[model samples]
Target: MSAQDDVDDVGEFAALLRALKERTDRSYGSLARRLAMNTSTLHRYCAGEAVPVDFAPVERFAALCGATPEERLELHRRWLLAVAARRRPRTASAPEDEPDTAADPPPLPRRPWYRRRRVAVGLAAACALLATLASLSVLPDGRRPAADRAPTAGPLASGTTEAKAPDRSSPSPTPSDSPATEQPSASATPKKKPSPAPSARTTAPPRSGRKPAAVPLTWSANSQAWKLGCGHDYVIAKPPRQVPPPPAPQDAGTWAATQGAVHGGETLVELSVQGRSDTAVVLNALRVRVVGRTAPAPGNAYAMDQGCGGAVTPRSFDVNLDKDRPIAHAVAGSDTGVPIPAVRMPYRVSAEDPEVLLVTARTVTCDCLWYLELDWSSQGRRGTVRIDDAGHPFRTSGIKGLPQYTYDTLARQWTPDS
Candidate 1:
């Protein structure tokens, strides 16, 4: 059957996988080869017959097909749902109106001959003891013996002897001296100590307190400067010819570090945050901290993507570094340049539901060294996570009227952008 037909049988996850695969216009064998998996397994995943154990394969497949970040996030959501569904137990359906026909219970097993004999012997001994007690008490008369009767509180008649009360102060009688019918003294009986009460720590649920140094939220931040249609650019002291062609998006961070590049004109910081556990984390705020400000660095700007058309605009916040105190303001719409009334704070994220914040800090006056602090709370624990460019503050400077260059596809060299 076709992938679409299989998707109809399975669910939305398979449908999305098939759609992404179809967009690439590649056969299962070719895609599977690139993904380093068996074609049949890939087919099963796309056809909804099976789900991948790990999301790594699914993400690699999406990247191979050039899925947008938003699409990748949606795919991750669907994958999480699929995983949950697979784990949930299914109960058998039954008609509530109909009464169940009870089956006959199995017969009890017979006791061993030796065990039955032992029980019979015990019963006989009990019967003999009861007969002996009756014979001793009756004395061939219908009345019970005087010793066997309960003592009366009234005074005794002239011919009758008075009963004496036992003295609690005296030592307990020996077992041989005590009457067979008498119970042991209360003092002689061993008292049981009450079981110790369970400890509060063991019985009660754990109390909420300050979490450890490691917060439950996991995050990564990347700083890049974009111009025109280019996603990331760098300002380096060396000329354009001295630098190699721009690296792929995944390698952009390392490439920038290697070239000793700094952000020019504007710096876009992308922060990806997700919870380490299944519990949801509330992102309280994203605050900016300016480390220092200096004059713009002297360098020529180089664009990563020269001829690429347009760029993907994610939900972003704008920060103007020229102000004494810069705050992140949420943008209303893509390319609208309208700031929302309030920042997008108090957002929820989880292992399954992640969040990405695009922060664009622009400056025309001074070079700024800045970093972000993300406040988050989860399960009653609140903390702040420092976001930076690989353990260092992100540096962005104004490039007003400085030399700017773009790679020319036709010339196979860097050419000045008009």
Candidate 2:
């Protein structure tokens, strides 16, 4: 009946609830809804901040916890005691017949006092009977109550007692007794989970086979310096490179171990030339633009082979450079928030060499220091050839090269090399 005595019970129930959630892989909110209890109420109970008011609420909770009926009833008994202790007076229990200040105020004298006399007698009889039953012994050995025993009947009744069935026509004894059954049909229809206002974070799972609507990309074609291409020529008919499995990041040291570039710049070019790589080929195009800024390079764009092999195949001369597509631009590099211990600097250029931008990005320390560098070169008669140190090559063979800046580490400054 006291908190100390109820501690074990409370802990047991909490553990059971946790086990249920784990078994079903349901969140507390979801389980609370299934239990027909307010989320906060269930949370409070689980936290031991407050005890459940009735066994029914706990019954559902136990069900969710996957507790057996026997376990549930035992838990219910303790739950009742804890709640009762909380509501109990600070002092010792009062005498059974003592006037309780917490009792409901008497009804207003709407009718004459004489007319209410029989009603008062009936109430007194009920109270007296309840008190007598309370005095009856609870057997140490559990057994069903005598079939003919009428608990509400006092000694005044004859030895032969008969139990009467509850009148079905009568309204339910308590709202808590019939919550699920009394719930409105509307409540039965799965309620659309309340969504957060636009700014609120979403925590719900996405529908099967569908993803959450993506946040609209803020960067658009108007912002892009070159047109992004579509159709067969632009289409990647075959994947050039296979994505390697990401190494397990067991610790900072493990993460740092994977810090180095997986492949060298030349290897990337080879992958692009052969179309044996996937994402690297697109990066190669950017490198071409970077390198082309300084000198004339052949305008011929190379298409990679179906497989990312050393073999290079030529595609029809596509006149247009596609730059309309959105690209994630990075500016700075550091490891401030990265789990790894290094920095990652990213740089981007529009479809041409002229529209270059720098991105500072964090590279989580893994097993490598993964550094990205950008450079350029010129092939006489061809045109400006820019190379992205991120291991991408771009060939602005026919297009006019844009002015670009090159970092001169010795000067500790950016120089107008283009």
> Best by TM-score, which number?
1
Per-residue C-alpha lDDT of model 1 across residues 111-216, encoded as one tens digit per residue: 2211110000001011111100000010111222323422111000000000112223534433332223111110100121111110000011112332223345
In model 1, the worst 10-residue window by lDDT is 153-162
lDDT of 2 at 4: 55
Candidate 2, run of 10 with poorest lDDT:
153-162
For each candidate, give its TM-score against the true structure: 0.48, 0.22
* Candidate 1 Cα misplacement greater than 4 A, ranges: 1-214, 224-229, 334-343
> Looking at model 1, how many pairs of residues clash?
0
- What's the count of clashing pairs in each model shown? 0, 66
Off by over 4 Å in 2: 1-3, 6-12, 91-418
